[model samples]
Target: MQKTNAQLRAQARGALAGQWGTNVLIIFLSVLLGGIISGIFGGMTNFETGSTQASILEFLVDNLLLFAFTYATYFVALYVVRGGRAEAGQIFVIFNKKYYVPMMIINFLNSIAGYIVGIIVFLPLAAVIGGGVYLSLVISNGQNFGAIADNAFSGVAIALLILLLMLVFLVAVSIVTGVFQFAAWTKMDFPNVKVGNSLRYGWSLLKGRVGRYIMLQLSFIGWYLLGILAFGVGVLWAIAYANVSVAAFYDEARKEIGDPV
Candidate 1:
């Protein structure tokens, strides 16, 4: 049977009962390394000014580090959940050549998927804004200020409505595409799995359970808000809690699907 979100969360809390120190250290190390990388490349890339090479290099390094840290967290979570002691050095596991190439491939595919989704979700809003701009220009050419003012009001209203609709589409897209959210986890579970097969396995694991996964995530909102209230200190704990909770979820999910957890 699939575990309830509550059960998974309780399991996470239990697994983390005496392991908070290691988990926090893992989170801290990843954040620290990421900050250092961003700092080094920050001055070299300016998106608006079109610094293409620097921007691409920064993007690549940032994503590689992201995948490495993310999978490392998963590695720790798996160990903790399985009743083993998690070590801080687990963070270096994903840097191995065996794991690095698959991480890059997954990262590339994710970037393409995000770009396509962004274009699709915001296409209407872009069209509405562009058409409004063109119409305003045409109206202003007539030297009719009153007509331009009226057109401006209607255009603003139309643009706002389209923006609202686009936000809804964005949320919908996130939920729909969330099935692939566990691709990295699949790779973590079966290290020898190819990138394509890992994605497929991840999809199969969550094909009908996306809503459950989403709800599990939503359950953390209150904890996250509380963390924010504590001047960001509590967020580290929340992050640790949430990461392990997700690992527990994956463990149970695989078992429920008759795969080795």
Candidate 2:
């Protein structure tokens, strides 16, 4: 039977009960590492004179660091989900090399997909904004407002169409992302699985359950808001809890799919 959101959360809380300190420490280290990386890049950008080569190198280094950190975090969650002892060193499992390239490839493809969706969603809006600016310039140059009134109405119609397109684009992207949400976890848990196979497996597991997954995430919005209300300190705990819950969900999903856990 599929687990309910409350049951999944309870399982997550149980898994985290005695490991809270370790998980909190992991979160702190992750944050510190990210801050240090940002500081290094920021210092380099600020102190070194900008050049095309320097900018290219900076961008490459930034992306590499981001990918490493992201994979490390994923490894940590995978460890927790697999019932391994959560330690700070678990995050370094990405350095195992066997998983590094595959993870990077998966992330790169996901990034490309996101960019395509973003362009499709925003291109019309961009055109509308550009046209609006041009119209404003014409008006400022003393073009007749009466003559442009029809054009303004047409622009309004185009803007409405863009809004509808953006809404549809967002929905489509959400569904796609939800379907593939567990691809990295699949790769981590089942080392033999390739990127494409892992994505397909994740989609198969999530079949007919994307709405439930979305609702599970939405259930935490209140805690997230409360974290923000607490001047961001609560956010650390919120993130830890949310990650554990997601890990718990992954565990349940694997079981439901009879994936030989």
Which one wins on lDDT? 1
In the range 1-261, model 2's lDDT, one tens digit per residue, is 778999988877777778877876777777888778777876766446577766665556645665666567656765765676788886666667787777777767776677788887878777775677577658767476555555554766777887798777866676566445578788877888778998888787777777777777778888889988999877777777777787777778778777733
TM-score of each: 0.82, 0.78
- Give the lowest summed-lDDT range of ten residues in model 1: 172-181
Query: Scored by CA lDDT, what does every candidate get?
Result: 0.74, 0.72
Residue pairs clashing, model 1: none
Deviation (Å) of 180 in candidate 1 = 4.4
Q: Pick the candidate with the highest TM-score.
A: 1
Candidate 2 yields a Cα-based lDDT of 0.72
For all predictions, the C-alpha RMSD in Å is: 3.5, 4.5
